[model samples]
Target: MNSVRRHALTGFAGLALVYLLLPIAVVILFSFNDPVGRFNYTWAGFTLDHWLNPLAVPGLGEAMRASIEIAFLSSLTATLLGTPIALALVRYAFRGRGTTNLFIFLPLTTPEVVLGASLLTLFLNLGVSTGFWTIVLAHIMFNVSFVVVTVRARLVGFDRHLEEAAMDLGANGWTTFTRVTLPLIAPGILAGALLAFALSIDDFVITLFTAGAQTTFPLWVYGASRIGVPPE
Candidate 1:
């Protein structure tokens, strides 16, 4: 009976994996298809043209460049703001620590639409125009929480003795931080940075609200879908 149950669970897991991967599989399969018309939804014939010249689609290259730039800038800003907060929360004791954590986590739990709308209201109230800078601010605001959490997770299991020993050995705060602390928490920083970049690049709802005249890759793709996404 136990063996049979185990087999059943394994079969279910396999089905779940296939269900999650089916769309990705379809996308990969259709990338090779050369549709005769604008809509590439229906497979016409297989060709290497799309793969060879990805920029064949008008405005795709520009949209992609915009996404890359925003992702990099937002991720960098989040990392810079969040790393110190994570280190402070984990390594030091302070007043209103619980409150700080709650505020940091609030954005993660808030609906994307709600967050976007709130930011829009905020910018309008402050008389700040919505554009590239507004989008950058919004992305950084949402991403900082994730960066803090990811970096904090890595710091949880870290050994404090190493930092203490370095300090005791006549190493100044700057030297210890640069030589020991930064290197030890490097993995968490990297993970947080990558996560921020991915979220910033793929974000649509927030970008929709915050971006006034600028169009990112996801926004361009969404608009193109109404007509028919150009095969590239």
Candidate 2:
């Protein structure tokens, strides 16, 4: 009975994995397809032409470059700003700590559509022009919350004795933080940065609201879908 149960669980896990990966497998398979028309929905023939000349389509390169730049800048800025906030919330007792924690979770709980609309309204009220910088700003705003949450989770399980040991060995506060605490929290920072990058690059609703003329990759894909999507 135990062996049978184990086999059943293994089968279930295999099915779940296939379910999750089926779409990705389809996308990979379709990338090599030589479509006869704008839509690459049906398989026609396999060719390497699309892979060889990925930027054959006009504006694809520009949109990709914009997406990469925004994702990098927003992720870096969010990580920098959020790391310190996570440290403070975890390592110190301060006024409004509870309120700050609540505010940090607000973005996570809030609907993306509502957040995008609110950001649009705020930008308009301030007479801020929607453009590349506006999109970056919006991405940073949302990314920071995720960064804080991720880093804070890492800090929650941190051992204080490592920093104490560094200090006991004649290290100053700055030295202890730089040498011990920073290294220990580096994984959390990296995880948060990667998460922010992914979120920024994949964002559509917020980017649509904030970007006036600049096109990111997701925005480009969305626009292309209206006509007919190219596999490349």
Question: What total of clashing residue pairs does each candidate reach?
Answer: 0, 0
lDDT by residue for model 2 over 1-232, one digit each (tens)?
A: 9999999999999999999999999989999998987888999999988888888898999999999999999999999999999999999999999999998889899988998899989999999999999999999998999999999999999999998898889999999989998998999999999999999999999899889989999999999988888878
Mark the regions of model 1 whose C-alpha exceeds 4 Å error after superposition: 1-16
For model 1, residues 1-232, the per-residue Cα lDDT tens digits are: 9999999999999999999999989988888988877787998988888888888678888888888999999999999999999999998999999999999999999999999999999999999999888999999999999999999999998998998999999999999999998999999999999999999999999999999988899999999999887666
Cα lDDT listed for each candidate: 0.94, 0.94
Global local distance difference test of model 1: 0.94
The C-alpha TM-scores of every prediction are 0.91, 0.96
lDDT of 1 at 223: 92
Query: What RMSD does model 1 have?
Result: 2.1
- For model 2, which pairs clash? none
Stretches of model 2 off by over 4 angstroms after superposition:
none
Assess the local accuracy of residue 103 in candidate 2 as a C-alpha lDDT between 0 and 100: 88
The TM-score that candidate 1 achieves is 0.91
Give the Å error, residue 83, model 1: 0.4
